[model samples]
Target: GAGVSQSPSNKVTEKGKDVELRCDPISGHTALYWYRQSLGQGLEFLIYFQGNSAPDKSGLPSDRFSAERTGGSVSTLTIQRTQQEDSAVYLCASSFLTASGNEQFFGPGTRLTVL
Candidate 1:
């Protein structure tokens, strides 16, 4: 029904802390994605989910980052042992199918500030 939504909008934590970010995609849309963008940087793909297909986790930056999608709708990304380098706007996006040629709607993102 609604467009994509993310929580907290902003976050601050010391290095090595764990954090979880949430995403809610639009109804009837079978495709979802997560991306990260540093200030003045391009979008960094994190993950994608579509129907029953195995998620594409290749974009995850490190072992500290992980995510999951349930029922083809909601998704969550957990970053373990956060780092100051992880500071960035973690954006979430969704589309009608696996990205590539498909346009994605993006969320405002959870801006994580790792100090």
Candidate 2:
């Protein structure tokens, strides 16, 4: 079985430009998550999607950041008007939603650099 995967492992973009980061989760996994890790910082939760439900987007930093999951499989994080502060490693994870807890499987992040 395939694990979570992210595309464009490294992205270098100019400030004010827009960037789209993609993630593919494991098959049949009911839950997916997006996170960002800035320099010297812990992983920051950006969004979460479960099945066909509306996503939990409370963790998104600003209006410039948005995400979408299609057919409960692939997800895309779009950063509009990129900023220097947005430079970070964007990580994706997937898991089964269980009552007790769900262990997350992570992907090699997409390193974003806004110059």
Candidate 3:
């Protein structure tokens, strides 16, 4: 079994471009999470998906940010009309059954550079 994985480990785009980051969580894990780490800032929780439902989307930076998990395994985070400030590393994590304590396994992350 593989751990969490992300594609296009690094990306570079212009300020107004839209970007889609992908994450593949551990198989059979019921809980998936998305996080963003900006330069000089701590890791920020972006969203969470339990099965196919997202119960906590409050952490999305704005309406331009959205994510969805399909079939309880894979997820994609879309950032529309990206900005320079949006440059950051997007990380994904998954846990078995529930997302509690230190049980979550995190992906290496996708580094997005918005020029």
Question: Among these predicted structures, which one has the highest lDDT?
Answer: 3
Best by TM-score: 3
Show where candidate 1 strays beyond 4 Å.
none
| Span of 10 residues, lowest total lDDT, candidate 3 | 94-103
RMSD of 2: 1.3
Please write out the lDDT profile of model 2 over residues 1-115, one tens digit for every residue: 8899999899999999999999999998889889999977778888898875545789999999999888988999999999999999999999987233779999999999999
| Structure candidate 2, residue pairs in collision | none
**Full-model lDDT, candidate 1:** 0.87
Which digits, one per residue and each the tens of the lDDT, describe model 3 over residues 11-109?
999988999999999998899999999977789998999999999999998999999988888999999999988999999999986636749999999
- C-alpha TM-scores of all predictions: 0.91, 0.94, 0.95
lDDT of 3: 0.92
Model 2: how far residue 58 lies from native, Å: 1.0
Better of 1 and 3 by TM-score: 3
Q: In terms of TM-score, how similar is model 2 to the real structure?
A: 0.94
lDDT per residue for candidate 1 within 1-115, as digits (tens), equals 5889998799999999999999888777789889999876677888888863546889999989988888988888999999988999999888888858988888889999999
| Model 3 residue 57 distance off true place after TM-score fit, in angstroms | 0.5
